[model samples]
Target chain A: MNPVARLSSTSTGQAAPSGLTGATVATNAAESFPPLGIRRGVLLGLAVFAVAAFLLSLAVGSVPIPLDEVVRVLLGVQASKDTWQTIVLVFRLPKAITALLAGAALSVAGLQMQTLFRNPLADPFALGISSGASLGVALAVLGGAAASVSVFGRAAYLGDFGLVTAASLGAAAVFALVLAIARRVQSVITLLVLGLMISYLAGAVVSVLIYFSIPEQVSAYLNWTFGSFGGVTWQQMRAFAPTLLLGLAAALFTAKPLNALLLGENYAASMGINVRAARWWVTASASLLAGAVTAFCGPIGFIGIAVPHLCRALFGSSDHRVLLPAALMLGGGLALIFDLISQMPGARAALPLNVVTSAVGAPVVLWIVLRRQSFGRV
Target chain B: MITHRFAFTRPRAIHSAPDAPPPNGDESAIRATDLITGYRNGTSRRVVHRGLNLSLSRGKLTALLGPNGAGKSTLMRTLCGLQPPLGGTVWIDGEPLHALSPERRARKLAVVLTDRVDVGYMTAYALAALGRTPYTRWDGRLTAEDEAIVQEAMRAARCEALAARAVAQLSDGERQRVMIARALAQQTPIILLDEPTAFLDLPRRIEIMHLLRDLAHQTGRALLISTHDLELALRYADALWLMGGDGTFVAGTPEQVHRRGELLRVFADEGTEVRRYLQEIHQRWTTS
Candidate 1:
């Protein structure tokens, strides 16, 4: 190789004739025209909507108090009627807050599962967590364990606390089994199939417990399974709120890794993410969330699976920094609306919470699946 | 014809000139000694290529060319420490490759695999920014420096325009470039790619090959690519690692491989006439 020839080539080679350069990428320029501020704007809009839904959930219940009285009671001001004050302060307010927390918890859990599995169809209950909670509730209510305690009693009564604790323990057990399976298998579909199998197994156990129990215990379990946000008292909420907060914190912390996992495990590993540790964190966080919610609110469905898709539809971005908060706000808002509907606007009879959730959530999920659109995987 | 032929010869030396630096210290070259590359079957390890000694130089594009199932991907995986070698040791710079922690290994070597990742709603910018994973905090937030590096990487890969576009919506060529941009963002001394242009059209293939070649010389990074595009590999790569079916490997300059007749011997069974013609043209171009 001639040194002079090489020196000359070095100068001329620096510029290739008529080659594609960074400036020629006009295809992306068309789509990139939308300002990124739209994402922040969308998040702000959802936050405002969430607050409105919270107020609406409080004001439009069975008593149908005006928005003004709801605000007055919330601010500790004397409202027009003491009955209205008592209803808003004692009954509906706690229920609305429960709905908000439960909604956020389940929805974020669903988002994690969908990202981890790289499957759009995945949700919090896909691993049979709800079934696990149901099994625990069946054992508590049908086994005559919870019947001994009065609702207002002290330590003597098992009551809702026993049911909540049992449900949580049951969810944790199922999650543990899934975690073990996840560790052993590398395939996403295999883990999902195993989860479905676990769900069936738990459902079979719950069926057996139902068949052996008395008619009264069966009805009690049935009512609990109807999934109402109203059953959570201020006392129960103290335990429920912290558990949810822990889970939400874990979820938020893993948002970056969740973004990496979107590209699949191999890609995630190349990016220096400890793929196994990330998976464990996601599993533990998701279990803590879905398990705690099911424990407190009887496995309220729809908002968990549907709210993430709703956020994606609105923001059109999958970056979890944006998606996490968006899902939280949207999930809470959706839950508030569903809980409001469950209150039965003009009628005395309240609808089951799951009924309204399924009515709204099922259609969105169906639309996503029917379109066969890619949710990060083919 | 004389001037036209001479024009092609000059670019080769200019591209090859960056190879003079010694690959040591933090700018470590990958060296494998008597390596056995393959997968595990039940309790025992299945050997694909045994007793392999290969060194990928710093600041050069080394193309690993072999037929289907010739153990190209397996060899690369073993070399990169993605999979443990069945028998031998791999050294990165001067340290044992497998001895390094995963985080440390990631900092030293970055990879671009052929696996099509579904990034959902993440933009090209966010995807490329993930290359800073080794340097970012536990929460994976990018610092100002990390952000600047990511932007520069996107620019070098000719994907700065794609920073705002969703990865899912990009064309195959664009996506491949973005994947390379991510590897660039990793800021590793050594970069490995498996079938980087498998799905790309001819023009995009040329662009990627040219981009990778330029990246190796300009950035002074060791780049090892496993590709079936023999023509581009011959033209762009400074060195060639030819894996033969008889469990033997040959490494040399493209001209030297042609001169030694190793290129014809290994590639003889398929495309014999084309390979012969390429050798004839290569012989004339060099000797003239």
Candidate 2:
């Protein structure tokens, strides 16, 4: 039998001490954690929830296709109407897929960041990856107007692809800078503060570009900042899906190092982990995930920061082996649900993705803080 | 005195190994030669201690006692390979410490640090299981043998009752035992601990000291601990490494060093009252 199961069995076999109150014994038993089987069952339930959320996302958009038709179109059967087929296959499917991928990628990245820094508040963007991407988008949209550069004219010809390339390059630039600094610095806190400074620098540069640009260019930058999942198209998925999958794979590979890190870096090194190499891998994977999502999906927020915390609470453990997969599914499911809410089912007008996410995410974050204060648990 | 009571309770049979020689002989588990320890920042260097030689032997508990700023931490860090020694070399089990790969070094040496392990929500069992990292696969999945060793280590540390409890929820004493359990689970021939008794109460300190001494005896592993608990160290430790903070170093059995008045001399700067109190305590214990 597995160690957890064996432990639980032994604990169950022992009678409570006579002096202990019933309430204290109950609390002790609860704190022992649910058995391994139940935790696995929770993961299974999360998988089902993710699938159901994806289906709902497909069926409940502004066009409102029926669930049966959505399933039929998914299974390669003919839909009753051609428009429904086009909507399901061409539009809704890609958007839903983007939401799923973006959510999972950001969440796994966030989980890594939280563990690496040992800060509960840390997210993928804590390293200023999204800010770096924003600077790229801002330069593409507003700097082009200010400088009137012909190089940007050609970039404009590539449309959204040009914007994505710019954002990716910008994020990569920051990632490189951070990695360079990480090599020299001994502490993660130094890296975190440097990241914030880099973010401010980028934000300041973008602000200058915005000040010089016309209203149309300014709005264009603003729309990107609002964030959206629907912006990614089928052709873009060729680049988007594979990048995210690679990032997620890298995250899964880091389970061992991350577990060691929970005891802190010194302890991790004592355990034979090459601390420097492990930190590099974690930063690289987290940067890649956050950067890629921001490039394709315009820096979606809340899902990255919130999902990992939610997973930790629900799963009742900090073991990366459990948290990584849990975050992947729960993050994707939450993102899909938020995306559905953004679509506003019966209304033609859609809310900005960030607006819906922040609206819901802020409260969840508040609840977590309150709960932690009351329970003295992280 | 409390020391005499605990001394009487100690299992003296474990010290009856016929072939075992006194410490500082050929049975040294870790040997440092002409060692210099310090920190370097860019172009500037600050040397803490210089040209020192030390050896820790198997089947013994050695207390590394020193006043604050006496280079105790720097020496410990250098010995564990956490920091590079400015000069000289350290050897573990006859192999140069710097030459060994991290994996090999981990297998040969384990450490329990003073750093607070705020591993939120991790069970003691799970935390102890991490000691199997060097032996386990890349994913750190513990094998059946690894699990059994972990359970045994916890049992040996007298923390088997805390196996299912979250480490975060453990009392300081319980947590210290769990951390010791982790080091024991590593199965290294040598273990180093920095201030293992700090932040613990009087009874807890004695309990931990007794446990460490017992562990060293039972497992025949060399154990070195840097601590501020002078009384406990004198009572429980087999040997003592005294860093006098004035470029003087002394090593010998606790009784030998005390007889030479080296312990009193090392802590002389603590103030006259502390020195006089230590002398009184020493007089009472020795006479009793």
DockQ top scorer: 1
* Segments in model 2 whose C-alpha atoms lie over 4 Å from true places: A1-38, A153-158, A376-378, B1-25
> How big is the positional error of residue A295 in model 1, measured in Å on the Cα after superposition?
1.4
DockQ of each: 0.25, 0.24
Q: Which number leads on lDDT?
A: 2
What is the per-residue lDDT of model 2 for residues B1-288, given as tens digits with 9 covering 90 to 100? 001111111222212223234334576889889999999888788999898999998879999999889999999989999999988989887778898788777777889998868886778988888887777777667655667566666655767678888787899999999999898878788889999999999999998998889778655688999998988998999999999878678999988997888888888777888889889977876887
Location of the lowest summed lDDT over 10 successive residues in candidate 2 chain B: B1-10
**Model 1, span B27-126: residue lDDT tens:** 4488877888998877987889999887888779999998887889899888877778888888876668877777877777899998867766667887
Listed per prediction, chain B TM-scores read: 0.87, 0.90
